[model samples]
Target: MEKKAVYPGSFDPFTNGHMDIVRKASAIFDRVYIVMAVNSEKRRAFDCRRMQEAMERALADSGIRNCEVSIYDGLIAEYTKHHGIGYMVRGLRNNMDYNYEENIAEVNKLIDPSLEYVYFRADNVAVSSSMVKELRHYGQDVSSYVPPAIAALLADGNTER
Candidate 1:
């Protein structure tokens, strides 16, 4: 059977940290679904289609061939289950996010004991999606924090909100 995993997130504009996790996960799983969470509280300027497009462009340049991008609404556990994904991939930047993710992981496990939670540590604690958004908001250069294609998308003024 092919190993499948889901990495769900807002991915407003694929950050370096997000790309890092996807790249690593793609190597381990036969197929990695780069799922964009449509119901996230953090509203994005771009819609689901745009987010997926930005992610695809970024992943393509990063050499992650075994991954596909899509959008999902509602609970991540349900989405994973429906897609036949036994594992959900998450990334951590620091200890601060551990508690929150751990709680969510527990709930997901309760929902389906067969569902596995895989966590990857960010390459650098300073690199994060929030930081990238802040930089873009302030008109600062965030090209280093995101893939070139994502940088181009952001530079094109798509995420003005």
Candidate 2:
């Protein structure tokens, strides 16, 4: 039997920190699914298709095997239940993130106690998708914070910069 985990995120623009969590999760699980959550509250510069393509390209460039990417448009716990994913992988950059994610984890636990939440501390605190997006919006160089493929996608987008 293979152990599968889901790493759900908006991933508007995949960042290096996100990749770090993916890589770490990949090592711990037989399969790691990088799920792009569709949230109306958060708008993305690239559509789902483009985001998936960029993520695939970045993962390939990084030589991260045993990982898959897909889009989910509902509650993460429900999606995980339907997909037979037992674990939810998350990345934490700071205490603020922990406070936010902890609340979500608690709610998800209440909804499904079988669901396990796994946290990964980001290797770098400053390399976040939000920061990358902000840098792009300000026309600052964000290549260092994201993979080349994602950086190019962000650079080409008019809304981001």
Candidate 3:
């Protein structure tokens, strides 16, 4: 059986930090799914289709051939089980992220006991989706924080500059 892992996140603008984790996971797993999570309660900067498309382009441009981009509306744990993925990839920047992800991992464990987690420390601890969006909101250049495709997408609607 192929070792497949799913990396789920809002990925509002698939940041460099996210790419770093995917790179790490792809190196270990036979396949890595970059899942764009849909949360109804949260207002998204971009739609799922757009996010997935941009991520696909980014992954391709980065020459990450073993990773696929997908969108998931339901629980990620369910998505992994339904797709026969046995691993999940997560990125940690600090203690706060550790606490938050730890709680979510526990819940996912209850839903799928066989699912395992692989964590990668952030390559750049200061980078995050929220920070990228905020910088774009102010018309600041965000090319360094995100992949080329995502940076272009975020630059499209940024009218401040």
Instruction: Output the number of the TM-score-best candidate.
Output: 3
Off by over 4 Å in 1: none
Candidate 3 Cα misplacement greater than 4 A, ranges: 158-161
Q: What does candidate 3 score on TM?
A: 0.94
Q: What is the C-alpha lDDT profile of model 3 across 59-119, one tens digit per residue?
A: 9998999999988789999999899999989999999988999999999999999999888
What would the TM-scores of all predictions be? 0.92, 0.92, 0.94
Candidate no. 2 TM-score:
0.92
- Model 3 residue 68 CA deviation (Å) reads 0.9
Clashing residue pair totals per candidate (backbone < 3 A): 0, 0, 0
lDDT (CA) per prediction: 0.83, 0.86, 0.88
lDDT of 2 by residue, 3-29 (tens): 989999988788888999999999999
Residue 108, model 1: Cα distance from true site in angstroms: 1.2
Poorest stretch of ten by lDDT in candidate 3:
152-161
